[model samples]
Target chain A: SVFNVPFTEKSSPGSTPALSDSSLQSDDEEFESVDALEIYDLISSISDPEHPLTLGQLAVVNLEDIQLDDSGNPNEIAEVIIKITPTITHCSLATLIGLGIRVRLERCLPPRYRIIIKVKEKTHQSENQVNKQLNDKERVSAACENDQLLKVISQMLSSCK
Target chain B: MSLSLVHTFTGHTDKCWATSIHSKLPLLATVSGDRTCRVYNLETKRLIVVLDDDSHSKTLSSVEWKPTGEFPSLAIGSFDSTISIWGNEEAVLEDEDNWTLMAIIEGHENEIKGVSWSHDGVYLASCSRDKSIWIWEADDNNEEFECVFVVQEHSQDVKHVTWHQHENVLASSSYDDTVKLFKQDDYDEDDWVNVADLTGHEGTVWSSDFEKKGERVTRLSSSSDDGTIRIWKILHAADDQPSIDSKLPSTIKTDTNQDMWELETILPIIHHGPIYSVAWGENGYIASVGSDGRIVVYKELNSKEWQIIISQPHSHGVYEINNIKWHGDRLITAGDDGLVKLWELAL
Candidate 1:
């Protein structure tokens, strides 16, 4: 565990990027598309594991680090990639932070969305290792099945807007 | 091939984790998040006993039946970071507490993910989130269990471990995106070594099962987060061809088994999400379940080919099936819906 860092939720999601892209939907794009800002909005409110501050307020999660790829096809595989920069370079809790984001999206999003959480490069001491564990479906699911881990994750999401 | 719903046993208050069938009895044992291991009679399709212990503070993640025992014995793994060996030690097996907690094995620092008894029943292997697999040597009485060997070869958390039907080989799937095989050395009998790492999966390997009745050229069916089921085969070192062991080993074993398991083929992809479990039926079919809420069965067309003969969506009524096992011709599945279903395959 590292020193607790305090940061609270954004009053509203990053509406600038999503609102500026006022492009109209295509004929086949009937389903509401989930964009980067929306994905960020979904997880940005998650509070830090040791602090009261939300990931958005702590600047651990940024809109630019979110990416979504949807072909607008219902049956196709839709992917959501999120990269979070740790406040400290050698943060040991990076994996837990990433897992919190992954669990949040997995619970809120549809089954088609393949969520991938990674530590932003150069921000974490072991970025690749944390990324591997966070993205593993079996590990992620097993962690969610864990009562203690789930309690912490739920606490992180308790203050979400 | 088709699976007709033969029977459904619904009693667990929460999601079911894993189920195991007794080799010598008409019984099925399933563990669930409710922190209980339930045993049901397959012949009568009735709830026989609900085994519960006060020591289990969390979900029971896995249940396994010892292949041979005087009385029925079960190895139950849990998220409480302990593996409890349960059995009826009384001379007369007649009481409300049909099962008694024999021993609580605790060594892993994290939750135990899977527990499996070897084909011979002398060895019980358990994999855990601590990234280590522990093999405990037990007796026929099930009263004593000694942690004999520990293999820490997997780079990440180990999900599941299963033994070969009649061999000493043990295959373990892991969150490290690989399946590793371990065996006791032919020369160094006390030492358990990682025989091979079957890599090629781009995502986490969830579970792997060894094909039953295949003695010489053994086969392994592995399910993974990559949404692919792969078949791996290996002959005895004496029978394997010269082309084996072609994949270079990063850490060479100075003295180990010379045999090597090579990738045979990948099953036709059917499920839309991560496959959580795979089982090679004693009836010679490969059955699989996954997070997609689908049950797919495959038949061997030949040595090099496999065909999807049965594909059923929403088998558990909107819940993901976590574990599936084959009992002779019948298929048994445990789902997140807290239901254990028995299906008859109409070939």
Candidate 2:
């Protein structure tokens, strides 16, 4: 029933600057460091499959939840950990959202950056299962290889800048 | 039908946004989000040169080669809101690495989306997120480009700019869900006017190209976020009548009739997601690549109907395909996977 209705702007408290507007900001001149805001910018604008609102507007991706662990050496590999919160406890598309975030980071970031996408603790009903599915190398690759699933994920990310 | 991978160019560090091939040479140039432009030789499957100097600091979006020039010249558009012209002076030189920056045109306030050179290589049209399309004239004697027209008629960001195959006309697609046609004023040689605006797509129009069917019939193909490829047929009017509403200034109206373009047909949904790029191939094949990582080729069965002849799903894995262009029989595609793949139709 929710899918049939067109979502008009009903302001919520979590509404911030839209991801489309913030992502268009020029990158920092300093290329040596990877900022956490950049990671937030990448995933915040992803449209939800159930709702027309962005992840940022739904409070699914917050700047505070993105953590970047660098070795302080530019040549060494860096690790990025993103903790995502689903809008509902029983949201079925959590894994799909996580996959979308993972794919976006993989395309935008360099090879040296290791990405870890996880469901925020207690945010979903099947948090452990969703986390395992999101982080499993073979499972992630297999989901990406699926043409039908990839189409849905692509639609979720189509609104991203 | 099936397709085979010919070659894969793994030079760009990030997503390759646009690609263009030289008219007379075995060269293909591609721009990437890595802020670099790479030119590769199709014959040897080797990279000729990489243009990643200090000139471009942001992502390079589009690149186009001059159709007819004394020497090989390229126009590159970047996210830094500027377009750089690179030229090779020594045409006969064996060295392919002698590319020098000729001019830098800085006018747009935001990212430059697309740059295209006219068929005769006289005019260069570029669109930008600033909702404007600027036309530059090439002064061969001075080796410089002068800004001639800046048309800010689009209500939203202009995504792509393409020139007609046989005329000086230019077509631009925008995020406003419309495609506009512009041509030089018949009465005044110095004035460029917006002749028509096509508004059938319900979502953003990403790319468009002209296909010259015969002597008088010219067709236009456009890909949009609505997940459909639309074909429009261009008809020349015998009398002075505007087919669509004229957004042009009243002073630019002349007594002669202008060309009329009507929506011809809508192709079936080949890709489930948004289609980003559509290119009319040289050998009567239409190739399209989209966000679903699939490249689908369509061919006309009879005089009226078009059908998908070849469908290559997962051509670039899971990443979105940014651009697809046909160089002779081979189809060159670049995408967010950071790989430039060449595909040939399998017999």
Report the Cα interface RMSD of each model, rounded to 1 decimal.
11.7, 16.3
Off by over 4 Å in 1: A1-42, A49-53, A57-93, A102-128, A135-138, A141-155, B89-96, B238-256
Model 2 lDDT tens row, B301-329: 76468999888776765466889998877
DockQ of 1: 0.07
lDDT of 1 by residue, B1-347 (tens): 57799988878766788999999878789998778888887888877778885768777899999997778788999887899998866534334366778888889988889999988899999999899999999978777788888898988889999988788888999988899888787677657877677889977888999888756437888999889999988754522434534453635433334467789999999887679999998788999998777889999999989999999887875466889998888888988667898998887
- Assess candidate 2 and give its lDDT: 0.78
Model 1 TM-score is 0.79
Q: If scored against the real structure, what TM-score would every candidate get?
A: 0.79, 0.69
Q: What ranges in model 2 sit over 4 Å off? A: A1-161, B92-94, B215-217, B237-258
What DockQ does each candidate score versus the true complex, computed on alpha carbons? 0.07, 0.04
* Candidate 1 C-alpha error for residue B147, in Å: 1.9
TM-score of chain A of each: 0.78, 0.78
